[model samples]
Target: MLTTLTDYRLWALPRNYVKIADAMIQEILDSGAVFEDIADAPVEYVESRGDLDVIFHELRGTKGCNVQACYDPYIDPPAIFVHLSGNTGRDNFSVLHELAHHQQRVGDAWADVTEDITDRAFIKELREKVANSFASRLLLHEDLIDSAFGSGPVTAAGVRWLFDNSAASMQACLYRSLELEGNRVVMQADSDGRLFFSAANSDELFPPHKDKTQEEIARSFDRLQASADGSLVVRGGYGIQHLSGKSYTNVVLDMVLCDGCVLVIATKGRSEQFAFSDDGEYYQGSVCHDSFLIKDSPGRCSTCNEPKCSKCKSCGCPDKQPPPCTRCFMLLSVNDVRAGLTAHEYC
Candidate 1:
């Protein structure tokens, strides 16, 4: 059931819960949780709740307590009853978002709303804003996402890192990741009603959802899902997208890398948002940069970072021999272990 913000237990909340919520917001902001740092957060589950579907206050005294907190403050606590129903859904960004609420002890009690909407309750909106910021940052911590973004192609592989870290939905993370790189990217979904997420500096990739008629979505969805690979390459629809390969393909969807144009649609695919891209542009990311995932792939002193360098005698990076770049040298010094080793899952 959808929860209305106004309807919740009021009298049973902790009298001081409001203050605790304030402190939590301040903490997250002081830590520099901004739009740029979306990928900085850790994505693991905090804990498990029981059969009691929703969690809130005592329903008697003041606005009650949060899921993981007592009347006492200081210890980090959650503000509401977070529904932990996501294992099959996208990466668990929702958990982190709710965690923000929990930490602030923001209760769902109606008293919070009737509390005069001024000082005490007045700051509620601001706190939620901070929690939202906290959640985004904690889930999409920029360093981690940037690391993966810089490391490899913004493909399913990198997304795995986001998933493991809890960066929320692939669409949001990819969009944010691209924004961090200063790229002009526009993302869209023409299925389940038309929806889109466009970069600030870029033009809209797809038309507004309202502008799309039912016929458009239905027809497009049909053409898109007919692929064996469960994906479709967009050729051009609203006269914006330019297809580099086939107009539409079941396996891969290629569009022109430009601003104000080019749209890729998932219509009906395993991945609602084409969050992972296998294009060459992704190879420029740090994850895939000059690194190949191969077991026993000998070291290469060559400037050309390639897998073939492993066996080639002319390669510059020799195994356990003198190093090439000072950076590479030191990296291999302690951890002579190579990329694609069975150690890491990507390997």
Candidate 2:
């Protein structure tokens, strides 16, 4: 459905790049090409199936190049050389990316050019982007992603599902899902906390942090620590201050350490009115109102002083330890965090 970059402007990619990517995907779909699962396929196996030779050689110091994969289309049947030294996920992605180039009829011409050196860099960048797009489409089919999100909200679990089911990396899965489910942001930061790359549906909602130093950004998010399981949600004053900017509010963040880097996903909460039931019971009456409210109000129950009455102060229920208010700073599930409220009333 997203035919143009404008339809999915969150990526902030060049219009021409999007145009080419769109055409490539459309052509693949039109030709009824079945995207086979290559997640477990070896590099040699993949190359063989694609009718290409596979070779592994040291390319680290060659031509000042440290690329993980390269496709030499000048050969009779073409060849894809994958750097076995690279990470498995990265190597797999690179192979698919090169295969995409082959599928799109993009070959060594872009690489073999000697004139217009300035333009060569730009052309190479464009071609790389197109190849990445193609690889993403091939590995993570549109239909599979649609089906995953069709059941419910696109939570951290859903992203993990896509990652497990596809040949893409966690970062790739996050970025792809952002395109599929607009209005979200994904950022990758180094272990030292320096932001390396970020992608979003809207810059206004999630601006670039490239200008800030690693320490500055880390301090903004309370010293940004990486979680092994990717379940950490930084909240409270530190999280709120850093996440909520001039154009955003009710921002929720989940971070995980991936290959010595931190991957963060921030979702801007939609403001929804919540009211207490007539009975004044917090759990029973705490319902999200369909109508939207511009400004958050404490509501009638929030200010009610009916005494504890042996009930939990948090939830207004007869219990021992009070449950934290959903409106306030609390560790919530991925789904709840994604559906965070800008305002809420507690009985």
Candidate 3:
């Protein structure tokens, strides 16, 4: 079954990248600060605060330098700095990333205690990932993304709307959308077509980088980039062969360009297979045939007309013919896509 952000609970972030980010969000909520419309004004809380300092200046370095932001948490008054070389969207994300670091440092004294750790490289990378996750969440909160998708289909244009409104980079918006409510995979490659990072709800559904050489991965990347025309479905052995060991026969790839990286969101053609229900009950199949057998099950399985089934209720089944299930591809309405794209047109 596909897992949504809600499945992880309000502040329980399961991914390693967002573990500290979740804690930071919980701290904000616990402080009684109202963040009702954070997406529109992300810096509103910290901008007027006396303790946090934000700076922007010309940050130059050697050629091909990609350092656009930095955060200093050890100082008396925490500070965040962003390179003045990027666009508004990039600068927004940089500030939020540093703020994420500030939140972590304030919440725990031991957050910086890893200085003595031998793995400095690993620690640095982990901290960056956490900060990135923080920036994404701070701008595009779980509730906000959930509500956006509640009435529409998730598309590249929909993600663009999120980027336009929130203080997140286009890449961050795309990545977070992939993690929301679908069995999706987001593969990121450099301009040269070298695969650097891949995030997916299921490892089995995504192509495994561990088994492929850099050249092989590059070839697959090229194919995906060439075929991607906003949205495209790759079928049969042509596309499946590159995936090698994956069990899926086909994949729907949504490609978008952000900065210098190509972000591709891949959805498997086959439904997910699992043996458990949301209510902590063990099951053997995708749908419950006789939901009444389970204790404390909901009245009936809306998907299958079975009594006492909690899975159907958990998925919010509409009780339509061939009932709505997370295992299959969701039918997206064209109107929903258009509405989402033009959601902020008048604003």
Candidate 4:
């Protein structure tokens, strides 16, 4: 039920998530069975836990269960514990994710077995990348994402479609889509006014290294989060936070909605610029940081920017566009279409 596994660079891994998801969806299409919004999708979700978590009730004893994709001990297939935690949180990605997992079960049984428990624990994380890849394509479907993203602006309503289908987080879905369209993205989080997740895009992985005076950063952050309300706001440390300046806003996060995706980097800071600067240069050491360019890569996008063959036409300056790159085009399309629909319906 457990095994030790080495971490592989996503680039070095033999499998390509983009391809795997496309093929998996083809398999479902080829199947004689009906593709109703059944329970086997790759990105299953629910409204109960506002936070995101993947489940594998069906993969426990399955063959490839020891493989990178089938690692969750939380749920076992065939007859899982609960009845339904299903809702379209990922919008366009959930069902596909779960379905792909089901597909993995068919081939994974005996594919490769692990000998330790940690690898098993890591399985949950592994499949997330896989299911994310699969669900994104299946729901977004290439042409649809491309056309939608290319035709107009990507909006929040577009985000709804992804949520409805995949059960993935709003940002995750956006990241996937924008990446398809040749943009890059990163994600971060906050914990006890310290650094947490630093999932940077392949391109801008350098700048955010600069550190503010850790003491001042912590105090400012603690002060802010304590008084944080509930809207996005710029803070002195780390990056940005959910609330503009509400209680508990001091230990803020770097929630930068740049390019087409979003990065929620969180940490503390003594001074605003010390903690975070939009500058691209790097200087200090471990006690310091990376260049601001690496930290804040998406200073390129603009609101109401049109969708050119490149990213947002309005920010039509970058010879390179931005993160959440073009490869993830489908999700962006879904983003745009959903936006228009929501606007038509609500706006």
Candidate 5:
């Protein structure tokens, strides 16, 4: 499904449908449909628009139906035929993705593309991409994303917050919340250590993730077994092995076990430690200036710019012992020591 740049040579790229999707959501909200109301019954909510009729059927063996859901523009009133996949999040997304197709037909958005120059497969891929984009926006908007995540990087709690707040799938929430940086990756794996999918930021320099779960992932599953409170999340640091025979150590990982799958967010190129203050705010304890998540941490050394440890009062600087004075031939006090001088300051 990964399409290269050359494939899009003759076809116009998909337009940004985020605004249109957001507008449609606004219209739905203005019609007195709250999120909770639409969440359980997305098809019902969309069907009420009178633009498209929803039909449920077993899509397999049906002529011309290959996807979980598809929109038929030729049909009078334009019907969206859906096969319930049992996964609520995915089913909802399929509905919305097909709805995007409905919009394309009504607006005649495909007219600008030169379809004859490209094969049908390329066109289908392009349209699918467009529809997926539209569906993602419809399920989760930017405003909601910011409100859920705040200023911190994507965390398990943030992912859970979005899941409870919106009707988007866990996969969609993870995809939408990701920061397009090369130093991070998000993965979904089953309980038995089988990877469903993995997504990395724009940096191709990062090595490919393993097809199956690594040792650390297995350890995480073991840790999850001790959750007496029934908590499904396990967050910690573990080395991740890349496919290139190299391993990134101490990668920050946040994992959540839900819907028979484990969702993981791994951050590389940084080490994070939580240090709390008396004011009830926590900061990233950067012992060696490796972490970039530092926030208002007190006791930063003016010389090294590293935070001084609360207990040791050390700022990652090496200890310097005063040398003996050449003239006195004795150990000198730190304050009295003068470097490269024959005598101390007092002398």
Candidate 6:
């Protein structure tokens, strides 16, 4: 099966760009340069590949440019100007993103995609997405992600772990986590509840233009318990009523606060069956009777050995049907007949 990362790249980037990016990554790996440790010296590694000039500039308020970095292939030997954000992870991403542009310029692949695209805005956006795909792949290699998170469910703690442990930026980890679990939305918002970034793999769209902030999402971070690595985490369902009058009711939010931003990993709300602790070490199951959360009993399926919720008795398998009622001669659901009963209780 194709990994979520592969699927995302195919969707976000042009085919030629993907091939070029993969080839570049493979070249780096073939050089015996530890690919997983690329974050440690990204600038050095990028510079080693070719003759490129690096410049640090304050790019704020620059007309026609709003990004933190840009590649200028017009200069002698080409130059990549980066505006440092002081955050190592984010800064490294900016550098790699610009380097990807440099590669595109050198390979002359720009001609391949630009001919048919008459819309300047679309061309610019496509180029940026292509560059982002390359940078994200370089920083968060598939192998590294697989090693960090094996085929387990993506959790808020897992997202926090990837950001805290790897060289990838928080946004990169959020995007990767979304790819891993395509049904959820991974969003980043300020402490004041203003949303700046969000990505979703689900059909339910986020509010158009991504500028609106709901106070409820921001307020949800209050009094959240902090884990060992200083990420504040909390889990609950909330009504995602955007300020623009668009609303989605009963969305499950798995939130974490780190580096002054609330990262909300959300899915469509469902009955609370099980919940993981802030560190993901403890699992709490809920009973159907009261939907009360219970602790310390991690039940398993007898046949498949798959873990089940001890209270609700839910596992990887589908709901089991009770034997048919002898009188009615119909397969019985749990509600109509009790287990091991050949006849309905009423019968």
* TM-score for candidate 5, residues paired by index: 0.58
lDDT of each: 0.35, 0.49, 0.50, 0.36, 0.55, 0.58
Q: Candidate 4, after superposition: displacement of residue 10 in Å?
A: 6.1
* lDDT tens digits, residue span 208-323, model 1: 23333222233455554554633444422322222221121112322211122223322212222233233421111112122222333453224544222223222222343322
Q: Estimate each model's TM-score.
A: 0.34, 0.54, 0.53, 0.39, 0.58, 0.63
lDDT of 6 by residue, 1-347 (tens): 21333322233323334554566555556757677556567888767756787777885332233347877877787877888878777778888888767666655445444555465654555567666666777777777677667797676667777887778789877866755634676778887767877776533324223776756666665554335443543334334544445444335677777677877777655424434332323222211111112243355567544344445464333345344444433334444454556556775
Q: Rank the candidates by lDDT, best first.
A: 6, 5, 3, 2, 4, 1
The sequence of per-residue lDDT tens digits that candidate 3 reaches over residues 185-244 is 566556454565555553224443633323322444456457544333332222222234
In candidate 6, stretches whose alpha carbon ends up further than 4 angstroms from where it belongs are 1-24, 27-37, 59-66, 108-120, 207-210, 226-237, 270-347
Q: lDDT tens digits, residues 1-347, model 2?
A: 33333322122253334445656655654555434534356365455465677777666322222237777778977877777754666677777677667655743333333123344444555567666665665566666687657756666556666776666776667656665645566776765556766666532233345543333235433343433454455432122122223122345565655555666666654213222233422221112111112222234233332222222122122222222233332222223334563223442
Stretch of 10 with least lDDT, candidate 4:
282-291
Cα TM-score of candidate 3:
0.53
Clashes of each: 49, 2, 0, 114, 0, 0
Query: Per-residue error at 332 for model 3, in Å?
Result: 37
RMSD of 5: 17.6
RMSD of each: 19.7, 14.9, 15.2, 16.1, 17.6, 14.1
Give me the runs in candidate 1 sitting further than 4 Å from their true place: 1-78, 84-92, 101-130, 142-148, 151-167, 170-175, 183-193, 196-207, 210-236, 239-347
Best by lDDT: 6
Q: Tell me the deviation in Å of residue 13 in model 2.
A: 4.2
The collision pairs in model 3 are: none
Instruction: Mark the 10 consecutive residues where model 3 has the least summed lDDT.
Output: 282-291
